[model samples]
Structures are given as C-alpha cells and as structure tokens.
Target: MTLPRYAYLGPAGTFTEAALRVMAPEGTAEHLPMVDVPSALGAVRSGEADYAVVAIENSVEGGVTATLDTLAEGEPLVILGEVVLSISFELVARPGTRIEDVARVSAHSHGLNQCRRWIAENLPGALQVPASSNAAAAVALADGSAEFDAALAPPGIGESLGLEVLVSGVSDRASSMTRFVRIGRPGELPEPTGADKTTLVVHLPSDRSGALLQMLEQFSARGVNLSRIESRPRGDRPGEYSFSMDAMGHVAEARVAEALIGLKRTCPVVLFLGSYPAFHGEVTPVEPETTDESFAEATAWVAALRDGRA
Candidate 1:
C-alpha cells in the first residue's frame, strides 16, 4: 500500500513544514513541500496530495492575508485540524561571513517586519531584501547567487542548510507564535472533541449602520463565545465586507447550531468553513439548558404546536 502524501508551504525548512511534520510524523506520509500556500492547497484540491498545511495567522503579524483570501475565494476546502507553533528567528550567514562582511540582509516580508527593530539596530546600513520565504532566502545563500550576506529565518533553517548563525533569538517579541491549519477536500468531518471550534464567514445583507451590530447580536443573544472575528472585502463591491469568525463550539452543539441558523437568516451569505478540534485544549463549557436533549425536546414541542397539539 502506498503511504498518503501531504503538501505544505515549503522548500523544506519552512515553519509550515515543521508544523506539518509534528502532525503527520516521519514515515507516516510522503511530505511534499510546495512553493507557496496556494500551491499547497492546490495540490490537495487537484488530488495530487491528501492534505495541505498552511499558515493561517501569526501572533505578531495578525492574519496571513494570502491564506485567508485563498480560503475565502478558491475552490471549497474544509479545515481538518490546526497547529500552533512558538516562533523565533536567527540571523544566519554563509560560511566565513561575519556581520561586518554583510552588505544586505534578506527574509520573507513578515520575517523582516517581525525583526525590523533588530535589523535596523544591528545591520544599520545593510539593504533589506524580501524573499518568497525565509527558507527561500537560505536556499539563495546556499546557491551562492544571493547578493545578501545573511537571512533571518527559523533556527532550523540554518542547521538544516549548513549555514552559520550570526545572531540568535532575533524576533522582537519572544512570545510570538503562528497558527497553521490542515485542509483537505470537503469530506467526513473530524469527530468533535469536547474542546472544538467552528469557523465561518458571514457576508452581510448590506452596509447599513447597524448591520454588523445586529449580526453580532445573534451570537451574543445565544451565548455563543466568539474567539475571533475579522472583516474582509466581499470582492465585488465597495463599502461591503464579509466577517470571518471562530466560535468556541462544534456545529453539533445546540448553541452553535442555533447561532448559525440565526446568522443565515440575517446575512446574505453564511459560508461554513469547518469545525475542528481546538489546539489550545480549551473546551466550551456545556450549559444545562442548551444540551442536545433540550434542543430536541424544544424542536419537537414547536412541531407539535404547529400540528394543533399545544
């Protein structure tokens, strides 16, 4: 039997690949590293791979617009799981190179932005070049064709690529972390753990003043705890946007299901992204009044009343 294949943002030493490795483990699957987040998802969408792992958000940089936009506009895909990794950067250079020997420094845009203060304070006069990824910067240096003398990347990139670390612990914030999601073709949903989260996008009916407030009331009134909410343009018009939110329960939960039903009636579009296990291990507190049995009883009561059985 052939082992399953997984795709991830790559050139091998990327943080996305590291997160995927932890989820899939070595020898469990054939991990293929794609050049970008879209390509990783494309591999799975095209049936070339079983799943793709891509960065969804970062602690220091907010949402990864590339991944967010892709998930919203591209072919339908469902998130299967998520992984959160603590992040750090190292300034690595080619053999025999020192900080003084460097004329330019390179990193991915986010990498450079996260370490902005460090680079400005240390390199002083070096040019800042943006690579597709930090690992790509390492590849360029290894290829001996890069004009840059050093790269700010995950420490593992340097060790794996045989580069020397010129400076360590370089991120501006030590507590920085990133969240990555595993996506696959829409299929069987993951069995809901007590601790789970459901993600969705809500496109409002209009841009009226109280529209957003009204939409939020659906969750608040239902006591649904929203862990995250972000707005993005609806792509076809001006002054209109869609809200992406993550709530603290699975769709199977009565409270969450009711809230979504309310959102669908109130919004022009309600895209169900996925409901997966929360990586944080934080479970939603179950309420006695909103248990599955209670919801079923209430649903039956309404049905009987409509049939003239008060």
Candidate 2:
C-alpha cells in the first residue's frame, strides 16, 4: 500500500507526533518532522510531502499562532481533513527521579505557559526553559544534552524516549484537545463526503463597516452553520485583519458554493483554504466510522476484494 506522506514537527515524540499516530496509523503514513509549524506546511506546499499536519488550536493554550500564520499564507495547499487530538502532557524524567528532585522544567515556550498555574504551586523554585519543540526537550534529557532534570512532553514521546512520567495530564484543564489539519495541493481536492467543511482566509473591504456581519449573513441566509472562526493580524497589517472561518457542508455543495460566492462579494479578497471532508465537527454519542479507502481495505478485505479472489 502506498500510504500518504505526512509531515509534522518532530525529533521523535511530541503531541503532534501523538496526534499523527492516532490520526493515521504507522505504515499508512510517512512522517516528516519539521523544525516548526510553518516549515511543516512548507513541506506540503513545496511538494515535499503528500500531506502536512500542524496544531492549529489547543484548548489549554488557545491558538497556535505559527500554524494559523502558515495557513493564512495560502499557497497551493488546501485542507484535506482535520484531526482533533486529545492532548495529555506529562512531566518526564530520565529515570528514578522523583518530581521533587527536579529543579527546573524545560518545554516548548507555550507548553510551559499552558501549565503555568500547576507549575507555579508544585515546583516554585524551578526555572522555566522554553525550547523550540517539546520533543526536542525530551531528546535533550535522554541524550544528557540538557541540564534540567525533567521537561514536559506528550506522553507518547516521553515513553518513546525511555523516560518516565513524573506528572500526568499537567494541563490546568483536563480533556484538553489540540486540532490538526491535513493539507495537500489545492488541485487534489478530497472527494465529497456529503459531510464536509469549508475554511476561508478572508480580508474584508475597508469601505464596509458591517463586512464581517455581512459575510456571516451570507452563510446564515443559506442556513449553514459556522463551525469555527478566528481572527488574526495579517502580519499586524495596518487596519487589516485576516479571518479564518469554518462552516458546515462541502465547498462543492450548492448551498456552500453559493455562500462562498456571496461571501467573496463582502471581502476585498478571500482565499479558499481548501474545502475538504470535515472531521470532528459534530458531537454525538457514537463516533462516525471513517470510510477512507485504505481503512476499508484493511478491515473489510472481503468487501475490498471485489474482482480478486472473491
């Protein structure tokens, strides 16, 4: 089987790695470990990988700016599918080291900050060292490259590097989840699943005061529900902002297509951020089964064996 090439930040273990592990099984993916979020997206835009995934938002830390920035760049890539990963962080140690033995904590800047309240009370004297990647911090400990006794990393990564979990689910909030998206060339639009999502990076026309309202009205008029929307500076552009929006229905759907076309009229310009099959949108009692061809081939071999030895 020719698995889709996947890219994410890596040195071995991290939440992104954990997310990828559950989002797509091994052998079904070829991992690309980028130095940062932007670089991960670059891997897909430059044809380096079949698809790229990056953390966009986290329940604890809020937004991941780097991921949003790259998404706003809007190269030839499009959103193929989204994976919402339940993130559980662990404070790790080399071995036989208790939590009290730790004098300092190292982690990705944001990762450290997200667990700020807990760290403040439990390890008050410990210094905070923010690195580029959380897994890289773990690597530092395993290789004795970092002087700190422990660092925070995704459970999967910490375990992978032969580290012990000193603290579990340290996020101030439990059940925290980070969202990731799989991106590919725009031309390679994912097939319609009837269940789909549309994400748009839009810059409204300055001349209009109710530009955003009007954009929402378009979707509202179509009776389409907006799943998510985020506003970020367009590189801190003077008097300009970029809005990233997600809405129900596939971009190819007549109602969605009409809404997008109407939305364009409200903005000076809008970039389609790849409308693909939506995942993790609705909350229900049962998780919808994935119908991706490879999944079927693996589990429904008889159904997949159509003309073969059946």
Q: Which numbered prediction scores highest in TM-score against the true structure? A: 1
lDDT of 1 at 76: 88
Q: CA lDDT, every prediction? A: 0.87, 0.77
TM-score per model over all chains? 0.94, 0.83
- Candidate 2: misplaced stretches above 4 Å? 1-3, 281-310
Global CA lDDT computed for model 1: 0.87
So what's the TM-score on candidate 2?
0.83
Candidate 1, which ten residues in sequence have the lowest lDDT sum?
283-292
Candidate closest to the true structure, highest lDDT: 1
The true-versus-predicted C-alpha distance at residue 43 of model 2, in Å, is 1.3
Per-residue CA lDDT of model 2 for 111-172, tens digit only, reads 88778888999888899998778989998998889978899887767788888888888887
Candidate 2 weakest ten by summed lDDT? 283-292
lDDT of 1 by residue, 1-310 (tens): 8988899887888888899998899888898988888888889889999998998888888888778878887688888899999888889998899898888999988888888887878889889999888899988888898888899888878877888988899987889899999998888888888799898988887878899899998888777888889998868878678888888888888888999999989998888889999999877887777777878899999999999998
lDDT of 2: 0.77
As a TM-score, model 1 comes out at: 0.94
